[model samples]
Target: MAASACATGLRGSLVSSFHGTWGTSMMGEDYPALIQSVPRYVRVGPPVRSPPCMKNVNEGKGIFAPAVVVTRNIIGKKRFNQLRGKAIALHSQVITEFCKAIGADGKQRQGLIRLAKKNGERLGFLA
Candidate 1:
């Protein structure tokens, strides 16, 4: 009975403390004024333009982008891009064949792609 009364008293005190002027003093009356003093919109300068050399730079794309970029640097851009396109087509064909062999559907194929992406990220290929 004493324990129950103590619990009730504690609960009541907690409730009262929550409902009381606890946080009001901490915030003070200038809280709203301080909030209103802050400017909503900030002025930004004009967009910066990239240099000519940086402008035409191809950073590559997809999960194999980093490797593609390295290969692109090794081989010339035009030739590398052509080869990359053909290689991508061949890779897609191979993946399609493998999927067919395993009886994997579109969803399974997507899962495989995601798994490959995850593996690539783990292997620092995405970096």
Candidate 2:
């Protein structure tokens, strides 16, 4: 089982394959641009609403409707550490946009996420 047979791809044997050999381990060296060139971020929106159940949460001494927000990000360990600042900056931008749209005083962060306001306990706005 000479390694040359695998290199030439004539017999398609494991002896000459790239799967497990120190011959080309440097090929594993990750280049940021090369990795970034690959499309990574895949966004899948929430499923169709199936008559959402009413969940109660306590707020200000009263039970209020709860809105759930869940996000999943696929970032490798090194990339996670590297993108911390970028992630925070994007979050800050979103916060700024929300504040500008709602005309909030930018004091209460909790108040910003849930921007639902009631008008005479009948119709409401959630944005």
Candidate number achieving the greatest TM-score relative to the actual structure: 1
User: Candidate 1 clashing pairs?
Assistant: none
Candidate 1 lDDT tens digits, 1-127? 9999999999988764344385886687888998799897754688777776633222343466677568777888789768856765676677778999989999988777677646655554443
Candidate 1: where are CA atoms >4 Å away?
1-70, 121-127
- Which run of 10 residues does model 2 get worst, by summed lDDT? 63-72
lDDT of each: 0.69, 0.47
Identify the runs in model 2 with alpha carbons over 4 angstroms from their true place.
1-76, 110-127
TM-score of 2: 0.25
* lDDT, candidate 2, at 64: 22
lDDT of 2 by residue, 21-50 (tens): 564565465655576787766546875668
> How many clashes does each candidate structure show, in the order listed?
0, 1
TM-score list, all predictions: 0.38, 0.25
